[model samples]
Target: MPIPMNAEPNDGCEGAVKGAGENIVAVSPAALSPDDEVALRRAIGELRRESLAMRLTALIGRQIGFIGLMVPEPIAETINKTAESALRSAMGIALASLGDRSTRDRRGLHKSVATMAGAAGGAFGLAGLPIELPFTTTVMLRSIADIAKSEGEDLSDPDVALACLEVFALGSSGAANPIERGGALEAGYFALRSLLAKSVSQAARHLLDRGLSNQASPLLVRFIAQVSARFGVVVSQKLAAQSVPLIGAASGAAINYAFVDHFQTLARGHFTMRRLERIYGIVMVRAEFERLARQI
Candidate 1:
């Protein structure tokens, strides 16, 4: 069942979560029921996988050497620049077109569209990247919006639209080892949100205040740039994978399938976290997320 977006907090639990056999720990009042805890645990497990980089590495690295080595300096630059531009357009135009339409999401439809685009791009190889990436990125954004809506987000809210955009950044962050960067809180899902929180808020404010006419405004650019920085890493990996010798349209389609699928997985986890955050406050959800990550 779809989780309710605006669930009311139940009375019983207050200020602390019950642990093993009556052991209690201080936490936010947004305590989960037994069932909700199970769902939260499953979502946290998915979030912790860090699968995109590893999946790409395994799939592509086996055929070619390390995925990173396949790309030349020029192509890498092109990938990064293309990613930035495509994301900017997605935020301005792609997501702007999305609205809360039906109860069920059209994930399959969006993925098929992206796959075909990838096939077309793959036929031309790297030369087709500039055109291919933007279209596919826009499709991905649409799929993400569908996921967000399924998770009970109000797409009419500029903040939620930006949150859909944030999924791109989240996918890249998951590929990295959050623990390696110092502290758990310093790097994982929460940290990434914290980092983008300012830009997202500012950009959302700009959209609300001025609309899409000033998409080039400094506030929006900063937000897009921040998202693009992390997003570019995955895009580079994708380019390197597609660069392997004789990777024709069919292979390109396969890679593109994975590409959209990766973000879709992250979107589900991300929006699920957001859904839980709405139910239980962020503090409680985050604390539980950390605890569950350790247990898992």
Candidate 2:
């Protein structure tokens, strides 16, 4: 005899009896229960709005900062126009990737822009506001890259503007290899040498232009040799992963701080004392690099 659906087994067992023939369990096609389905939809909607707002905010901040730093009005305007176009292209790409067919809220984007502009105006209005040209330029470049990423665009292609950034952050040896031993130490030395070379080269050019050609030759030769040595260090670390944050943060902070010479001196000492500590310091400085990257 067949066991009933609700019957317990009588063979000294307290559990329900198994069916003799094949038994089938039916499952609904929907993975979520009705309440869960509604909750999920609400959550997704909120996330989409939040993401859009954050991107908009970053775009506005970057654009305003770039424009505010330019000294010449015409040049600034030209650069601003070009930057705006680039931003639009990036945003379009992002929207398409997200499957968002709706047009973006221009008013909202403009509002963000206006707010940033106002803040910039107030900050620059103060007397003796030091110019942060390099930091602003870096921010603009990062913004452009972020836009591209959000649009699902591949900035890793050699033809892309973001290739330099990718190489700086992820390393130039491609994804398959690990950093070579002693590469980090070499990178620190090369970076310092590169700075020294730039300083020397600039000084030489200035002296030569002032009709001190005789004085400039010796300095130029020394700078050339320094640059060559720097190149050797760079080559040694060529296979290593570039810590984007470290370089970016250090450079950015150097731009903002007034006593950059003092800071650089301290940095050199740190590099000499401990290689990992130097790298960590650089990473800490460029903490914004990752956050800015994710915005795009």
Candidate 3:
């Protein structure tokens, strides 16, 4: 059953794909259960509505309180270095305790984000980067782990756990298309999904068997470094937002709040599309998704 190009998008409907004269769905011949189909459709709907430019605009946009403040070069470098170190530490801890994290509610995670942000923002550099950096990084790592759980990916397995690491790397991907209008945003989303989707499992296996750094495949370690760089970009922007004279802890906390919140949304959307891809075939979903993207 070839779906006509003119057919209206029902959003909630699980349409079929033509195959061998049999009415086969894209990923299976049998129809998906109502609940599963609904989940799939909802995920697809989100992908269609997600705007690359809008997300980028929000990421790079100045914080309301410190719009015109300029970040000094040394201060910027400190921000990036601290963030990179934090992320490196975070990855080590996550790997070591991969299977040991106890069940946690999102409420706990939310509180953690606020607490770290509050502490980091309260006196920030006044208290030394050592104190502030760990607090913020640990909080972020835990939040990212929670996001992995929500996505139905198990963190116990090295393969699955590495995927969570990739999410942080993908966080600051808004630079590609800063324009609010045009198809660039949609194209950017697809490009991002493509980059992160392949080689995750393979890379994870290599990392686990090789143990931490030095002996680990140079290529795999490099990939992890690249991900850290993405996070570094975010940290740089955040320091800029919080660096203004008299900006205070409240403003810094606000910036931290936005940072974690943005990544959580990213995980949800990415996993949703992944589920849909498993069910409907990536080619089909991408084609239809791109079509919807063009319309939007």
Query: Which candidate number would show the highest lDDT if scored against the true structure?
Result: 1
Model 2 off-target regions past 4 Å? 1-122, 125-130, 162-296
Q: What is the C-alpha lDDT profile of model 2 across 60-99, one tens digit per residue?
A: 3332222333336553343334323332333234222332
Of 1 and 2, the candidate ahead on TM-score is 1
Worst lDDT run of 10 residues, candidate 2, spans 234-243
- Local accuracy of candidate 1 as per-residue lDDT tens digits, 1-296: 12222222233233332211232333234368888788787777656665565766566554332566567888778878998999988877776676555646789999999989877786676788889888989999988988888878887667787888888887776454433333366666777887887787677667767777888899988988899887887887777677777665666677788888988887888888887766665556766777776776
Please identify model 1 stretches exceeding 4 Å from their true place.
1-30, 61-65, 174-183, 247-250
Candidate order by TM-score, decreasing, is 1, 3, 2
Predicted candidate 3 versus true structure: per-residue lDDT over 6-62, tens digit per residue: 222323334453322234444332345576555555554443443333332354464
Highest-scoring model, TM-score: 1
> Candidates ranked by lDDT, best first?
1, 3, 2
Clashes of each: 0, 5, 0
How high is each candidate's TM-score? 0.83, 0.17, 0.68
RMSD of each: 7.0, 27.4, 8.2
Cα lDDT of candidate 2 equals 0.28
Q: What local distance difference test score does each model get?
A: 0.72, 0.28, 0.53
- List residue ranges in candidate 3 displaced over 4 A: 1-77, 100-104, 107-118, 126-130, 175-187, 196-202, 211-217, 294-296
Minimum summed lDDT over a 10-residue window in model 3 is located at 1-10
lDDT score, candidate 3, position 167: 62
